[model samples]
Target: MSALEERNRRVLVIDDNVEIHRYLREILEGGAEDAEFDAMDAALFGTGAGPIAMRFDVTSVYRGEDGIEAARRAREEGAPFSLAFVDVRMPAGIDGVETLERIWGEDPEMQAVICTAHAEVSWNRILARLGAPQRFLVLKKPFDAVEVRQMACALTEKWLQEANLRQGEARTRAMLIAVPDAMLRVSTEGRCEDLRAVGAPQLELDDMLPGQAAVAAREAVASVLAGGPTEVFEVEREDLGRLYEARVARAGEGDALLLLRDVTDRRRAELAAAQRQLHEETIAAQAEMMLALSTPLLPIHEDVVVMPLVGALDSRRVEKVREVLIQGVADRGVSIAILDMTGVPSLDAELVDEIVATARAIRLLGAESVLTGLGSGVARTLVEQGADLGGIRIHRDLGAGVAYALRARGGRAARS
Candidate 1:
């Protein structure tokens, strides 16, 4: 054992007689040839060899005042005496009762025995003065050595046990303080037995959760006690403008534990992400609709097709136009395809190339392509860009293109 553990086994002896202090020291701190050990060895083994002695550090004081001072000093040094033997009738200063009162005020865990030859004070008066029946003992003067040793061993063990209990309580308090949610222990009937807000600084039990919350919490607790699953509910505080998620679970013996966690920030983030996804989906649908309107293919006659170009025709829209024209010619099996640009606002070199490319694509599909709705500005743009519309028929409007396609088909029929 460390010296500190040995020091905790210390005893204090308070008496006016100098001889009483000497006797106690010899008995508590046993010598090599101690009479008590020798007697024990003789009884146990029928031998006179002294047995192993147990030693205790004993402090001696002549007066009650001096004994109280010694006890105070031991407490300050963190190595307090586990027990004190105080004489009831000390000639100087306070008596045993008064000295014990002062010493216990400083260290209440210190056990003590009153040493006296006469009953100078009544037992009721002594109990009234000390107010600790379990911690106080009475030992007549000229006490037995074996009784003293037993008292020292038992009281010291009791002191250590009580110290351990206090340390455990302190650790529990620290753990509760470090937790970041509001907690409550509620009975089966939903009565709040204990509540702690160690980490929730903003929570006010009185004002934050009042009548409605108590009712709801009790209902949740009832559900869990009925062998139902754990329950969770949201509580919104309009005054505080915050949201809390309350969880209730059975905690044995007809009671439940409630934990409330704040989740307003998390809820807001989820809402924002959902709104962004919806906006992107809406924009995609609108873009698809606009692409369909930009390239419209309609059959005007038997084996004839017409495509009208409209709006701003960027490179992306031009590619969409080419796809629609080729698919329409194959699906409809057209012999003549017409390009209409009546609704087009303006034309550039890029747009002129796109138009010429569409006409060439139609010819490659074994169909004659007729260009109609050729405004002066668009025709001039096609010429300036040197776009090649090789062997492609041109008309002023959609009416003229349809009439010429019918006439050409009639001429072919007559020849056959």
Candidate 2:
């Protein structure tokens, strides 16, 4: 940009001197490609500001009364003046300072430059009346054209910067309020500058209050301010039908943020998973037990395994029982083999023949068979069916049968 364009020119000239008005407008508005102009003569005093150019706008007035009136009318029309050149020595209707006050009331951002040559009009007097005089500029009557243009251009840029700053602040505040979570602003000095709770519920923090004002529910804030590692703390409350657990955490330096979600569902899911694990273990144990019982087993101890035989003996059971007795006797190295028929219901002729063959089979294998679950009725039926048991020994119960077998073997030993 050129020196003129960088100034961003928009000039409002208010003076009683017709030549002065023309001079101020000419010097302030000329040589700008994007500036607006409303050049006015003394006769055009009370006309309001011109229409706002899309880029910039400027207006001029003749008298102080006319300037104040035009300022009011420009404000009503929503086209604010940016830079005003006010003459100090005006007629008694109003002076430059009073007009300056009214101009600010209409548009607070308008920058004014007091144009004067009077020694009696002190600097403090005009400044004190115009509120914060540093915001304005003052040029003497004998100033050159370049000096007037410089002052006007500087004030115009100053107004634009001020307007930009105010708009930026307004936008920032709007964004801050739109956040969904609670936000806190603190300094490193442990001073809380601001706190805004967006979705947090109102709590009875009378007892937990910090300072004198509820301690502000700010553990997370305190953690951040102390330069500690960020941490999460759970606070449970039964406020809902079920329990609700709140997880609070520190977010960043000088700031703490909070997000809340219900975790009752997650807890229940964990519990259900544990129960399913236990049920699976139980099923595995039951399967192991069935496997142990259904399959045959080797004898585990040096003791007898008394397997009593009952109902009609099938050939499959006869073979299984024979295998159990022979293996048990051989493994334990025991002396007696007693076949006590105490509960046999109705032995098949062929099955009885198989049982005797099994006992003989046990003898050959260095062990013996003992069948103890037969009754007298089964014995008689076995004899009537012509089942063969001539060479095998039998007994009603284990005691008498073992005694007879012992004596008979002893007699054979004595004879030998």
Candidate 3:
């Protein structure tokens, strides 16, 4: 414990009788080592370690007005009493109820006990005058020494607990003020009261946000204040060229806290990346379409169709060629399907086998397959790969292939 926290327990006594004050001082201060008092402390506070031995610094005032003045001075001097014992009837000045009221005005945290001898003092009236039971208790004037000690210990401990809690809250608020994000404390109705900002000093609530963003901010605040969960929303200010993310949460009764941070660079980087990704996807799609269009199937005669294959023939491209040739022959009932591979740059042994297989598929559809425009290297590769070309005819070029098909079909002329 700190030196200040370990200081003597401060108590105030307000009564017209001087004997009552002396008796209380003796009971509180002189009963430190009494076994009965130690037992009472253990029973109340659950401390089994012998006597607490707390010292008392008691202040006594005969009149209620003087008690009030003393209480006020104690508070101003940074030595406020933790508890006060007040007698109900003080004939020289304001009564106990009025004196406690004035003392509370000075130090609202001060715990009080109203002492009265008569049974007909109207506790209901006293309760009505003072607000609630958490801060004050009533004591019969012929004081039980044990009860007095118990009240003094319990009420003083309660006051200390409350003081620690308040200090924690103050420190928390001080830390919040140093945060980089702009913060606002607003009422349920969206009235901004306290604003703390490290960077954006001019940043404010809904007024600073534009269009639907302002409306969204107010709605978020209302939702948090209505006991809903915390809300997160984002808004962009084109005028400032900045985007901000805001979070709203309940602070106290009927109050909401709003915190905002600038996310402009992050938002712009995301948009730029998205645009780049979309552009790359669009170019890839166009390339695929162009590749499909590059290999075109043309029908020159009634029963003859020619496809000029181009590009480096991978497995995927060769499979596409097979699909187009077989489907076209089935649809047109062509007797001769010629595959002219003049534009193909290169081929492997596996690709050569794939080409032979394509020709076989066309023959199965009741059409004669003609292979043309094979360079010396591709033809050499076909021989080296040991490809089966049993049902297909090979021609040197497209013209020779077309001429041979026409002659087999009774020498038909070219279409106009």
By lDDT, the best candidate is 3
Query: Could you report the Cα RMSD, in angstroms, for every candidate shown?
Result: 7.9, 15.0, 9.2
Error of 2 at 82 (Å): 1.0
Which residue pairs show collisions in model 3?
none
- Residue 212 in model 1: shift from native, Å? 2.2
Superposed Cα deviation of residue 160, candidate 1 (Å): 3.0
C-alpha TM-scores of all predictions: 0.61, 0.46, 0.59
Model 1 score (lDDT)? 0.80
Ranking by TM-score: 1, 3, 2
For residues 273-380, what per-residue lDDT tens digits would candidate 3 score against the true structure? Answer: 999999999998987787677667899888789999876788877887888899899999899999998888678989998999999999899999999999877888
> Model 2: runs farther than 4 Å from truth?
1-8, 31-58, 181-416
- lDDT tens per residue, model 2, 1-416: 44435443556778877888766655654545324233342225433434322222456777787887777776678666778888898775688888888878777778888989898888888767776876788888876987876776577778878888888877776676675433444433334333443344444333222343323346555665576555454444444434333333455655554443446677789889999999999998886564434323333223323444445556666666666667666777744556555556677667777777867776676554555545666777677877666556666675555455446456442344
Q: Give Cα distance to truth, residue 385, candidate 3, Å.
A: 1.7
Is 2 or 3 the stronger prediction by TM-score?
3
